[model samples]
Target: MGYSPTHFKSINPYNEEIVCEVPMHTKEEARQIVQNSQEAYINEWINTNYEQRAKLLNAVAKEMKDNLDYYALPMTEEMGKPINEARGEVNKAAWAAEHYASFAEEYLKTEYIESDATESYVQYLPLGVTLGVLPWNAPFWLAFRYLAPALMSGNTCIMKHDSHTPLCALRIVEAFTKVGFPTNVVQNLMVGHSLLEDVIRHEYVMGVSLTGSSKAGAAVGAIAGSEIKPVVLELGGSDPAIILADTQDLEKAADVVVLSRYINAGQSCIAAKRIIVEEPIYEKFIDLLKERFEKLKLGDPKDESTTIGPIARRELVEEMHEQVDKSVAAGARLVLGGQRLDDMQGFFFPVTILADVEPGMVVSCQETFGPIASIIKVKDEEEAIKIANATDYGLGGSVWTGDVEKGKKLASRIVTGQVSINGIVKSDPRLPSGGVKKSGLGKELGPHGIKMFVNTQQVWVGPVKS
Candidate 1:
């Protein structure tokens, strides 16, 4: 491959070896892609009926399922997610594609309004090319979450995936092409962050959907807003897992809490970052969590036995360590595994746990995107709720309790995009997921997701006189 100054080199987080390099598209090439997507939207995609779109979407899903093993490799290599978890991410993406394909028609059906003079109704119409700015963590799942819904709504897309995972990003575009999507229908632009503003402000691009840091969101949102274009942002999250006083299943709760926190090495936006346990069961939960943390094996992501893997990059590992250090200095007790594994070749950090974690500490207030569990002791359910909602983020939170009704009540009180009762907060194809406050702007998934880039046009008939 030809090397350019703008080419992105993918590095394996497991071994710190160079995987491959992908050349960045020039400004002219990026403009052409956007224009081509707009043409596709106007000429063919928008005119196609829901049945035709659904057929193609389902075909894409089938292709993904057939090549699950093939696709999971790149994801695991580039991002250090466990091989099994990478495969699971592919499966979830395929499921999302099929889910949107099966339900888009019903979700977008015209709504009839009764009137005295004449008939009136509302119909969902397709917008033009949408710009998807996706992140590297769970690369396939995050892109598909927006791609499936955007395509199902008859809108074409131009994706600007994370710079670190160019190979995985290209494979995503290839999947659509392999499934018989026309050229430019779902294009991936291998470009740098400098070009993001130009793409978002392009005349042909109608909307923007992003999943990234709050800083990135603010930059993109500003451009989209200036152009009077709609933008959906899924930004940073410091999610909390509340363990109530009456939670009877401490073992089960501990298991879920550990899995939710350390899965994807805690890089996920919705990972359980803060563990808030009531005073009565606080010590019990902490002991159980400590045991669970001790059992995690940090090694090669490709190893099926490895529960914790390296962070996606060295910079992230450094940042996580800094947070841990500052939090420790601020009086958070380092219960276990607070040091980085300097002997390891790759970006491996220990499954660290900080006890007596309280407000004002770095781990408690900031979004730490690594396998560091910060446990906070709460006086009661009210304090748990208060602590959970203390952060500026309101992405996803959960309540653990044996009483389902009580859990639901507490979940409702927490100000977040989505909450779980007796379970972990996760993105589902059947449910709407997004956030409020600084967390994000709009929703994704469910019927609401498919409509994010569409226009709700009202059709009115002429009055008929008697």
Candidate 2:
């Protein structure tokens, strides 16, 4: 039959305006992704040697780096993510390709082992075609996170990206092909989420990975579980940035909070949504934060001077506005920067700080994926950890203390899958990225992430000569 991607709009979150109307793939068309990837996997890609796969991955990373500005510009235009943020995602996203390029060989190699009876061996095998239902906020990074690892493990990828980010999903497929990946190694489905459950139920889809909300993750988990197939989920986070009274540099702590929350206009799952400061330094922290927020230029992403820009979508801006309103209704006070910039033509919610934020407050428990942080004062590290761990999320957290031992100790106690001491941390290809509790199951990015889709095989012999 005939097929065409459905129409979808991406609004400039800065000024509440339409940025673009993208064509989305229909369910019928979406089915092609899995079919094509499956064909590629079993036909040609599966047989490609590890050296060739690594070479292709490295070429893709190089292609991405070479065209960083081209990708970043479009990302900023479509998603309203600040220019630098999009560029950094490009750089960081390339790490996956680089990582797989250098490491996939050793990772997939068969290893010698010994059993009591005789000789033994261990080898890794790849799963078949995998479906990745991706998110928009960090489109390039998330899409490739699955691509790099899955391909490294010998599994071809079929991706159904967020409708709001169809261009990003398509562009990534282009990147793969440009880097010399054979046809269908990574296929982008321009379809709607309506087709997700049906596609995951497809026999060709051996595994799946999703990065989105908790509710969404649960739904995917249920489907994948029922199918008895594997899935990796990296869900939501209201990560906390804990500040100690004895922190050596209060200004640096404030700066860290500002940068962490405002990146991508705070549309990150691991963004520091909560700022828990010890009471002794709370007032000073607030003052410095206000000063820094004022200095942050909020305007056009292409402008070299703009540090913050419109959010990704208008609905997100409205939602963020409602959150601040509900927080006020619930007795939270704004220390500085709340509400939308009315004159701007994009979806722009000003960087906001809600003080006296309590657990049930709108800005407290909720994962406000905007430039908003709920600030709470704590008497000591115990309360800081308590407040930090109070949420259903366990994605990421940070501890600020001059004492290295105390910082490390506090990080150990926090429930998050990743934490940083004295600085804000993003997921590195070197460190596995996943979460505990409600955040997600399984992992992505590092060696463990790459191996998640791999099958371990053991072979045994009757006896040994020795």
lDDT by residue for model 2 (1-466), tens: 0123457666555444555666776677777778888899999988988888888998888888999987776678777777888898998889878888788777668888767647788888998899898988888988888888788889998888776766676678888888678998888766655777889999899998999999999999999999999999999998999999888988888888898988887889988899998999888888888888778778887776788887776667788899899998989888888866877766678888888888778788889998887888889999999989999999999999989799999999999899999999688887788998899999887778887887888888876546
In terms of lDDT, the poorest run of 10 residues in model 1 is: 1-10
Estimated TM-score for each candidate: 0.97, 0.94
Best by lDDT: 1
User: How does model 2 fare in lDDT?
Assistant: 0.83
Candidate 2 has a TM-score of 0.94
RMSD of each: 1.8, 2.7
Backbone clash pairs in model 2 (N, Cα, C under 3 Å; residues 3+ apart or in different chains), count: 15
What do the candidate models score in CA lDDT, each in turn?
0.90, 0.83
Top candidate by TM-score: 1
Instruction: Give the clashing residue pairs of candidate 1, or none.
Output: none
